[model samples]
Target chain A: MTALIAGAASTTFGKHDDLSARELFRDAAEAAIGLVSLTAVDIDAVYVGNFMGALTDDQGHMGALMADYLGIPDVPTATVESACASSGTAVSRAVDAIDAGQADVVLVGGVEMMYATGIAVITDALANAADNEYENEAGLTFPGIYALMAREYMNTYDVSEEDLAQVAVKNRRNGVSNPISQFQEEVTIEEVLEARPIAPPLGLFDCCPITDGASALIVVSPEFAANHGLSPDVRIAGRGQAGDTLALQDREDMGRTRAAERAAERAYTAAGIVPEDIDVCEVHDCFTIAELLAVESLGLCERGEGATLTTTGETAKEGRIPVNTSGGLIAKGHPVGATGVAQLVEIVKQLEGRHPNQVPDSAIGVTHNVGGSGASAVVHVLEVAG
Target chain B: MTASWYESFAAAVDREEPQYRRCAACGESGLPPRQTCPTCGEPEMIDAPLSMSATVVAATEIHVTTPKFEGEAPYTVVIAEFDENVRLTGQLSGNEDVRPGDGVTVGVERREDWPPVITFTPS
Candidate 1:
C-alpha cells in the first residue's frame, strides 16, 4: 500500500534566538501531531534527520533525545544522516517502513541548529560531507565546489554573472510573501551583481544563511490514515534516491549531477509522471547555482537551459512552472538537516491551499534534495488528492 | 609526527605512494581506500601513482576562505581528471586564468595548521 503524508509542520526557517534543538523539534512535532486526530502514542516509530547536532551543539543520539523529549521514549527510533539530504532520506525510510508493514504510522523529524557554532566549526562540520582525503584535504569548501560548477556552467553555456543574479532576484521576490523566509526583502539584479563575493562568481547573497529550525511530518499508510479520521491532501505517489562517488573528480560530467538524474528517473517512473506533470517543485538551492542545476537535473529543463529559464522568468511564481515557492534555501534559509522535510512541508501546504505563496491550479508537486555536492539525492513526487 | 602543513602533506604523499588499487572490473582508481569498487562493485583490483599530471576538468576562485584558513582568502580550487580516470580536487597554483582541459601537475604547499596540501600547478 502507498504511504500518505497526513500532516506536516515546520518552525520558521531562520535563525531563532531562543529555541533549542529539542524545543524546535517539539514545536514542529506538536504542530504536526496536533493536526491529526491521533496523538504521538499512535506513532509506531520515530525517525530524526540531523547532520551536525554533535559538533554544533555537542548533542548526539538525537533520536533518543528527541524521542525522550517528546514523551515517546519506547518507540523505535533511528537517526538518518545523508548530509543535507538527511531529512529527505528520513521521509524515504518512513515510506519504506509503512510499505513493509513494519509500522502503520511514523513520525519523521529533521532539525538543525547551526547558528550556535563558530564559522570555522561549521565549515569543518560541513566539510565532513566531502571526501576527507581528497576534497577537504585540498581545502575545498562547499562554496568552492559549487563555484567550480558555476564557472563551468558559465563557460560552457556563455551564461553571464547577470544571468546567475536573476535567480537570486527572482527567489527574493517570492520570499516577500513567505513569512518564514529569512530574506523577505526583494533584491534587484544590480544588488545581486554588487553583493560581496563569497566565491568569485558566487557572491555573499548567493549563499543561504546558517539557520536554526526543525520540520516534522506524519506519514501513514493510506488505509491507516483513513481509519484514523485523517484525510490527507497529499499522497506520496513516488520516491527515489541515488548515491554517487564522494569525489567530484570521479564523475564524468562536473556540471551535471548524475545522482539527481537517477533519483528523478526512478521517481518519475514510479509515479508514472513526467516533468510536465509537476506544477511546482521545492529543490535544493543551498546556493543560487544549485537551484539552476537542480532545474536541469530534475528534467524540468534541458542541460544548459537552467540559466535560460531563470533569465526568461519562466521559473517565477507566475510563470509556466513555479520553483521554490518556499523561497528556497537562498531566501527561506537552510538549516541543513531540516531543509528536506521543510521542502515537503512547503509542497504539502501548496497542495492544501494553505501556502502563503500558493501557485494557482497546482496539483502535482516534487521535492529534490541533494547531499554534499551530488553524492546523494532523493526525489519524491506527490499528488493532490481529489 | 610533526603537525606542520608540509609534514602533513608529506605524510599523505608517503601513505598514498604505493601499489594503488585500480578496480580491474570498473577501471576507476580507488583513492585513500575503499572496501569495494564504487563503479563496478567488484572486489578484484590491480595496483597502479595515479598520473602525477592531469587535465583540469573544472576550476573556481574562492573569494572567502574558511575562517580557520582565512589567511588563504582568494585561492583557486580545481578538479582535475587524472589519467587513471579518477578525479582529484585540489588547490590550483600559478596563473589565475586556469580553465577546463588545462594540464596541471600535483605539487605540495604548506598551510597554517596542516602540512603541505596537494596542490596543482598549470603544467
Candidate 2:
C-alpha cells in the first residue's frame, strides 16, 4: 500500500521573471507527466504546495488554479500550506490517500513565485511563517532567528564560524555540476568566512537566496505502477511530520530541533531503516547551520558533532554520507513552497541512479523539510526498487 | 486576546520596570503573555516583575533584517534567561559587545506610532 514515485521533474530554479507560480507549476507538471506513461486524464487527485501566493501573487485557490491550468479541472484538487513544508505535506497527504485506498494515481506539485515582489515584500511575506505576534513584532527576522541558533550552536559546541562556512563551500561545490542550480560555482571556506555578514556568525553565503521555481512528482500506488509499466522502484517508504512551539524562545532548547527528531523517528520507524542505511539525503538547508542540525536530528551524527562533518569532508558527495548532492537549498535555491518537493525530486533522482552527481549505488535516500524555524517538519524515506 | 501582548510589556516599561506573566500553578512565565499557561493550561496566570538581572544564553548580531527593520541592520539579538527560568528574546541595548553568559537587565525602547520594543542592557 506504499505510494511509489514513478516520475519527478523540476524547473531551473532561479529568478523566473516572466512566469507566474501557476505557469511555473504547469511547466513542471507537464515535464513530470511527460516522464511517466500517464496523462492529465489519468491523475485521480492533485495537490499543490505553495506558500505566500496570496501575498506574492494576489492569488489563492492554488489547487484549483493548477487543475485548470493542467486541463484537469474535474479532478479533486487542494493546496497545502505549512510554510516551507507546504509541498512536503502535500506529498504526505497524497500518500495518505493512496494508503487509504482513495486513489491510484496522484500528482503532487510545489510552486513559489517570489521574484514577483521586491526583497522587502518577500521578507515580510516570509516572516508570516513565524509568530507575528511576538517574533516578528519584536523585529526578529528569519536570519535573526537562525542567527540566534547559530550563535548557540557555535558557543555550545565550541565551534567557530569557519567550521560552519565549510557547509556553504561544500554545497556550492556540489552545485557546480547541477545545471539547474542557481549558484553553479565552487567556493572556498575562506571566501565563505569573509563574505558580507547577514547575521553574525552567518555570512551572506551562509543563507539561501530568494528563489522562484517549481517542482513536481507523480505518485502512484504499487498496483498502478506495476500494471502501467511505470518505474515503481522509487517507493515512498516512510513519511512523518512533527510540530513544535511556533516561537523560538518558547523552545526548551534552541540548540536542537525536537521537531526534526520526532519527524525523523517516525519516518525511520515506517521505513524500517536507520540513519546508517541512508545512502544520500537532500535536507532543508535553508541556512548552512540547518544542514548540521538536520543531520544531527536525524541521528546521522551525534549532537554537537555536526560542525565537524564538513571539516572532515564526510558529508561531501564522495564522502561517507553524501548530503545535499543536489546543491541543497544553499546552492540549488529555495523557493519556499517548492523546496520540499524539490528535495523529493532530488532523492528520486539519486535512488534511480540518474542524479547529476550520483552517489554510487545509492539505494536509500531521505528528504527533510523544515517549516518556519523548526516549528514544523516533514521527513520522507525513499528506497530504490529491488 | 488583547490587540497585542507586547503592549503589556510596553506599559510596564513606561513605568521603568518590565513585567512578564507567570502561572502560579505551573511556575511558567514569558513575555507576550498568553491567556493560560502553555505548560499546564492554568488560567490563574499573574503578571510579575521580570528579574532585574539575567544572563545571555545566546547572542547574535544580525547584519540583515526584514523591511520593517531595514535601517536597523547589524543589531544584536539575544536570548536571555530571567528569574524562574523564563527566557525571552530582545535586542541588546547600547549596541554592546555581548556573548553567551553575559549579564544584562531588561529595558524598553518606545517607537513612535508602534508598541515599545524590549531590550537588554549590559548590567
Highest TM-score scorer? 2
- What Cα-based lDDT does every candidate model obtain? 0.85, 0.87
Candidate 1 residues lying further than 4 Å off, grouped into runs, are B1-20, B94-96, B110-115
Off by over 4 Å in 2: B30-32, B40-46
Q: Per-residue lDDT of A39-89 in model 1, one digit per residue for the tens?
A: 888889999999999988888888888888988899999989999999999
Model 2 clash pairs?
Answer: A233-A385
Tens digit per residue, CA lDDT, model 2, A1-386: 37899879999999899988889999999999998987899999999999999999999899999989999999989999999999999999999889988889999989999886987798889899998766776678888789888877777787888888889999999999998899999889889988998877788899998999999999999888788777666999898899988889888788888899999999999999999999999999888899999999989899999988878999999999999999999999999988999999999999888888999999999999999999999999999876
Scored by DockQ, the top model is 2
Give candidates' CA RMSD values in order: 2.7, 1.9
Show pairs that collide, candidate 1. Answer: A249-B87, B5-B114, B5-B115, B5-B116, B6-B115, B6-B116
Which of the numbered candidates is closest to the native, going by highest lDDT? Answer: 2
lDDT of 1 at A144: 83
